[model samples]
Target: MPRIRSLFNPSGKMDKLVFVDSTKYGNHTRRAPRPGLKKGEPALKRQFSRTKYLNDLAGELNSAFRGIWPAKKSDLYQKMLKRFRKEPENRRGLLLMQLKSMEINPRYTFNSLGTCSTTVKELEESVSVGLQVQAHPPRGKYDANTYYYEVILFTWDDPNDTAFWSRQYSDWIRIGKDYPNPVFEFLFPKPSGTTLQWLLCLRVHLGVEDVVFPVLTTTGMQITDVGTFDKDEIRILEQRKQEEEKAKKKAKAAVDDIVRVKAKNQQ
Candidate 1:
């Protein structure tokens, strides 16, 4: 039987292990995440739960924004393994993964974290669609409040996560749980990042940083009917996106064919 190693040396030789707690940084530096996570704050222990949620959300949003849904919305966002088992390989998996992402959760609704609260601390009823898409000044009820926001409409989130895209790479597959988990990053150049400045500013002004949407932890998550205003917004965005995608694919195909023929002639 063989035993494992414990120490090492500077001369590239073996030596005893040494334990050192090194800061070299500052105090306000983050501590082990206390189930709370904010940008810029450094913590030794990562917010793993948040990590999983963000990864899954990024996967869903990236595809959903691109207008690709494989199964009925109900079956689409389940964990990859569970989703494949219930739906067809062709009709299921990545197709739905993409589709689920493209969807914008309703205003009275939310996905992942929780559902919308019927109450708001403040709003400009002056801007009529009062119950619909308009974002208010702040919620008066709580000392601090966070409102859910989505760029295209009711779905609330920073669009940066949406930018990590699958392009001319036409073939799509479900990000599998068993395989080396693929990390999805949608990079937003410069001020283009949707999650950071704009959304965060609005959320902070509304004092919602301390609040959490109630639906995420609840057992049953419900989907509300898309209202007249919400429906129009969703339809317009989807149509525009579909048109853009078709144009892109057509252009890519033409370039690919030309390149192939030119290579063949050269050969």
Candidate 2:
């Protein structure tokens, strides 16, 4: 073990050497040679292929939903990798299912708060997603009088496409003597491609005064049906375009409001 006392002593990697910082034993340096895969080895090639696919998928997912993940980025990535490894034959399908059911916050599940039901409808030129949430009685410390929920929608027509369409709805739902049932509807143009998959997530928030904070222990997520449509049938409705613009503005405003609140509190 060697101590790193200089301004730039390296704490990650430098060519053939790797550096690590350990609290108990101090800084350590070791030789970690990068291994290259040889040609014609089918078994090793398959392993490498799987590893790369998983890594790329995990990285994309983490990047796409950076601020929304319930757990640490590394932990979530490792969990997805482990689950995918268990069913190597059905990695894509398994990964989608796992993500659909993942809780943003494990300590307080969305189901504990209420019942959520979703419906998907495929029309001639567009697809519609409807979400219905029915509130339940307050349980434990989650009994906030003024709490709201937000829905996140992510859609991609092509698996290879790096850009995707996203929209979020952040409406406050006040809990009263009678539990309220809030319904949300989202519409997206049918992709010109052969297939389109959309991921939808529900997040609950607690409102204190003018500050709104996410509930770190709830989970509500689902992957909608993948639809196939003819390229000729693709058309974006003007109303849908307006709705998307509105959603984007609302999302930005929500983020800005949270930032302002945090800054005010710090002051």
Highest-scoring model, TM-score: 2
- Window of ten residues with lowest summed lDDT in model 1: 195-204
lDDT of 2 by residue, 53-124 (tens): 777766766676666654433466676566567554423433454465665444555556656677766666
Candidate 2 regions with alpha-carbon error over 4 angstroms: 1-39, 69-74, 90-94, 137-143, 163-165, 189-195, 208-267
Model 1 vs truth, CA RMSD: 22.0
Q: Measured by C-alpha RMSD in angstroms, how accurate is candidate 2?
A: 20.7
**lDDT of all predictions:** 0.31, 0.58
* Total residue pair clashes for candidate 1: 22
Steric overlap count per candidate: 22, 1
lDDT of 1 by residue, 27-126 (tens): 1222344333454455423444345544565455435533632222443344433433332322211222323322233231233332222211112221
